[model samples]
Target: MLKKYILFFALIYILTGCGTDYMLSSFYLRKDFTWPTSPSEQKSLNYYKHVDGDLTKFNGYTSPSILATPANYLLVIYEIRDIPIYTKVYGVDGSSDMGVYVAISKNAETFSATPIRVGGIADDYGSPVSFVKGNRVVVLATGGIGFGNGKADEITKISVSISTNNGYNWTAWTNVIDTNIFKPLLAKANRFYTNPGNGTVLVNGTLVCMIDYKANGADTTPAGAAIIYSTDNGITWQLGSTLTYSGHRWARVIAERTDGKLLIAAVPNTTRNVDNIYNSNGALAWYMADSLNGNISSFQPSGLPNNSGGSIAGDRIQYSENGRSKSGILLLHSTPNRDYKNPGAGGATGKVKNAMSMSISSDEGQTWTLITNAIGQQEPYDKTSFRQSMKVLKDGSIVTCIEEGDKNVINDTSNQPFFIVYKRMGLSALSDGKYSYEGL
Candidate 1:
């Protein structure tokens, strides 16, 4: 029996170099394996003030985006509050100072000792999305003046920065899409703004990025997603179409299908309070866009749970399997499985959730099934895992980076610090051998 098992393992290793890893992972999953945490230095850090006027330090990371290249994996995160107090407590104007940083890894497991600062501002409203072709890498983020401070006439736009050398250094931030084009739309609303999204998908020689658009500063519900396109490999950009609705749409993400259709997923939030907008959105809204530009009618509720978490969808990847070529496009999603909104326990605002989950869909967003929980499903609520981004690598492996609350680093009962967690595994390993593919 021992020799038979050895021969079976050897045959798998001979068939695929990573096959043994997946088989072992599958066995471990049956045993309920514990996923490891990220390196200590990669966690985020910020300061908070106590009632007695003492300043204290905390650790946390948020809004992580990941990109895959031939030689390395790049992870971008909104890390470290450079300011003294929390944004929800004092406000967005003079209180919170968030910085954007990028960490590079030759292998997805180990990353740079210290991440390099990319872009950030006093009032950064959205996460960053990255695109890469050859040596040129582009990152787009939401930038504006005095956002969430309840001030009027505030301008918010999607800002872009380019790194010619693989995310090691980035240029000064500039608006990717000009707000002037939306002047007609802005005329109808008080403070028209755009926030960059989780990911972008390429279709028919164009890169389309789905962003959240707000008609006005005072409006409770968002104006739905605004599609932005780039025909020149993310060098230049323009606005395509703005999808509007009566309900609230938050944290919208997009991906392309094998048949050239685009799948958009957003957080369907019904909460009226501005403070709870980001805190709770129990379900995901799915929209099938027939084209890259328009034709999306309405987003229906998906089978995913009401996790109150920001959902991120990955771009599709075409791969071969069982010796066949160009088999299918694989799409992946990351979100917490349960609603994570509590008044004063989880994080600083107590608005986030834990138990980051990964779901897979091979049928172009038609159906989704949970593959695995990247973070432990039973972790404490304060051990938050939220706002993660994923990518399918050229090596048939999937890489992701998640923002998790550092349990040891506390800001207070209401809020906690966060850190970035980097994870990479073979798709077969992640699915417990349910899915496997050959790199194209």
Candidate 2:
């Protein structure tokens, strides 16, 4: 009876602003600190792990979406999990009380230790994507769907919440992107599950973001992604034609090129122990299209280097130096470096998600070169880094939040315990002496 009462009160605490009194400090680098000259040296500096500062408050954190607002503040939205709360609220096997929380930072270095929770609908499968336009920041999270009765079902709907003054407070959760748009493709109800991409890009005056959907429940194949856009500041959303490939594709990352083209990067929808046929070459799939509509069925293999098993994030930046006379479109993507299919020597041990690398393209993602092999400081094969999101700041610095955990349970998707690791460096630092950032 005592234990039961203790659990009840603990649930109440979490549901009603649990981290209000928490003051978790992050390890921040000095503003004037001299950055390293080599790419290897830059990758090893300024990495900080963040949670509620205590495992008891939040057990795990994953699916981080990092955004750089025009006001120069860095905002991150990620999924927070507490086992007891999840088991009770969700009442499903391997359930965890899942919620989307936003952490704010003035500079990339220091952050708000106590994060503000973005109220969710179902509060499960909270993979959030956030973007900013001026002071109005919008976050779209994957919720209002249930995975119970020993199977996953429901036409996954995205919950939209907005904050007028940055991310201090958010409005009530509302559904966006009508379900009728997907009715033609679904054979029956709950046949498709949708997850928001890493970030959204504002093109001209419209807001565009990628939404990846896959066959849910008993179905195993026939998955695709779409481009959803809004002109009235996220009041209403319209979906583009379905972008399908040969095999299942999801976890897309979108960016706007200097030429005003939309670049969508996606990966195969497969997990550990599943046969990975789509990513046999260790690269992310790419689709270059217009912001509004285009034939996305012609997605080809992106030469961008990656581990090819997890989510990826990227953005586009323009480079122009007055004296040097260098100008071009710069595309950057960050993902795990391991190739699951070609895990040499020790097989699975050689393919752990320990190293998160950043790949850069000078000619609008036509060709990419591996720039930095490590973004966050993690021991190879000892710590696991998975599911990362990044945004290039107005000052030309790149910031990322990595989902990392103990490598012992790398195969375990749930209850493995994870932390959101933050890292940032100038584009020049990550690129060595090759390129320097003038602005975004």
| Candidate maximizing TM-score | 2
Q: lDDT score of model 2?
A: 0.58
**Candidate 1 runs further than 4 Å off:** 1-60, 77-79, 84-95, 119-126, 149-151, 189-198, 215-221, 245-247, 270-281, 299-302, 318-354, 374-383, 407-415
Model 1: worst 10 consecutive residues (lDDT sum): 45-54
lDDT (0 to 1) per candidate: 0.53, 0.58
Per-prediction TM-score: 0.70, 0.73
Runs in model 2 deviating more than 4 A are 1-59, 84-96, 120-125, 146-154, 179-197, 214-216, 219-222, 251-253, 272-281, 297-303, 320-354, 378-382, 412-416
Query: What CA root-mean-square deviation does each model show from the true structure?
Result: 11.5, 11.9
* lDDT (tens digit, per residue) of candidate 1 on 1-440: 99999999898877577666675876655433222222221122111111010124333355667776544544554444454343231112323565567777543445677777885333453356667766667777655532343556655556777788777777777776555765655565433333332456564556667666554343345566676777787767776666665454544545666677676666564454423433444556667777755587565634555654344555554533344444343434434434443345544333233356666555566665676644422223435444566676665555666655454222345555445666666555555555555453
